[model samples]
Target: MSLSVSAVPPLLPAASYEYRTVRPVHHGHMGEPRTDVLAAEEPLEISLVYGPEEARRRRTLAVTMRTPGDDAALAAGFLLTEGIIQHKAELRAVVPCPDVTKAEERGNVIRAELVPGIVFDEARLERHFYTSSSCGVCGKTSIEAVQAASCPVLPAPAPLLPAALVHELPQRLRAAQAVFDQTGGLHAAALFRPAGELLLTCEDVGRHNAVDKLVGHALLRDWLPLHALVLLVSGRASFELVQKAAVAGLPVLAAVGAPSSLAVQAAEQFGLTLLGFVRDNRFNIYTHPERITG
Candidate 1:
């Protein structure tokens, strides 16, 4: 499903709309019922708008089930991690598709306009981009298939972080998760300086989307090649999370949960410092421990 080009609407702030309602839940032994706030989950259709100004084209890239906040950053980050755009300058603008008349559809369809002269690879589009909430790169057939979609992440030369600083990150990351605090049902991704200060944080129902939002925020701010900072995820590290961090040139990735076997492999292959089970003042470094100092 593609959309035709029209007058671009003013960029709206990314927002998370309520998709679920709270109901009273009665416990077996409790007299009073409790109410719960669930994280909103909805489909966001990401589309690509590119070509010469006179002869432009649009294509629906992917439909992802994500929490609605930071939709633009999610789209931009998706492209950046997919190797569709190497730098922030490649993107002209990310706006809600104006052709959709329904108010509900307005923010759900995002159009990523490319800078003039950059070619859009339709073949690559056919191979990658479509994803689900559980898996971001479901189209990849093999390990090489995944590696082909992204450039190798180079090793960091400076800004070595202390091991103690690394352990302190999860607490800082947890403190910044406002949405998760309310719902207790969202995943978070945070960017941190080597000295242990939080740079930015994003949350979503999908762990991958959270990472994408964080990467997209950095991309929009011209902060690519994030070699001097660490990326921390609130859930167990997966292959897709590692891939996104690697594409953004993030040198260190720490997770509060364990990492999958393939995630560890990807981190080792990309020379990224992958930490797992980072809680209670302890963490296990799965790869590239050299980047973490005493």
Candidate 2:
């Protein structure tokens, strides 16, 4: 049941950005025509299959509007952070759904098949979720519905990261974002070691999707309980992003922009180190500052 990254079934690749012809206008005059690199926004339908081996059932989990790359990771990360599946061992395979009418859109739908013998209530699917490229997951209906069951109160931050190292991470993350550099239209999530090494990075139109992709990427490689790493996001830290990081056992969540009031509250509740305004050689640690030194 322990599958290495090479042994795991691969998800089909898709374009993260695309080119389109557009007219550039400077001041009041229309400038020359140019090809613009725009982040590709497409809906990814995530489906789940689980049941007894003899009788399997398929259910649609969520349809997320995201940049087209890392579709499988998005699904797997979504499932893990959502507490639907705990680890990669629960997943039998992740592949693009081939039962689509449009050949081009085949890459837009991904399927995560769970190993048989997992028990979950089918009625829980009754609460429909509305996901967007900007807002992450929505329509949870209540606080209980929105809360992730996996996040435990993380212990004190140990082997603390240097404040100087945290300051330079935004640049390192920016350097790794190839699609964002081209389109200037994608959000990113990255992991870093205490020594400031960039471990992994993922970019997507949806900020939440980017984090999900990170979770998926790590989950497939059996990197759960990511207690030793720090997570950095390209945008503001939202409660949803904080929840995802906490569930993945990341001790610190830093954002280039501000943290919402709700995000701060959630971080406090989950015993996570919430940081914001992590740019211009400065950053703010909102909670649990024991993890950062100097």
Best by lDDT: 2
User: What lDDT tens digits, residue by residue, belong to model 2 across residues 1-294?
Assistant: 222333222222447667899999989899989999988898999999999999999999888899887787889999988778887889999999989898767788898999999876566566532233255543332223445355567776445889999899999999888777788998888888789878888888889999999989889888787888889999999878888898898899999999987778778878889989999999999988888898
| Residues 1-294 of candidate 1: C-alpha lDDT, one tens digit per residue | 111223121121235534343444467544444455667788999999888889998889889999887899999999998879898888999998889987778778999999989975679878674343356443333345657766575665746889988888888888887777767888888888788878788888899999998888888777778878889999999877888898888899999999988788878887888999998989998998888888
C-alpha lDDT of residue 217 in model 1:
82
Regions of candidate 2 where Cα sits further than 4 Å from its true position: 1-14, 128-148
- After superposition, the stretches of candidate 1 with alpha carbons farther than 4 Å from their true spots are 1-27, 33-35, 129-141
TM-score on alpha carbons, each prediction: 0.86, 0.89
What is the C-alpha local distance difference test score of candidate 1? Answer: 0.80
Candidate closest to the true structure, highest TM-score = 2
- At residue 258, give the lDDT of candidate 2: 99
Residue-pair clashes per candidate: 0, 0
Among all windows of ten consecutive residues in candidate 2, which has the lowest summed lDDT? 1-10
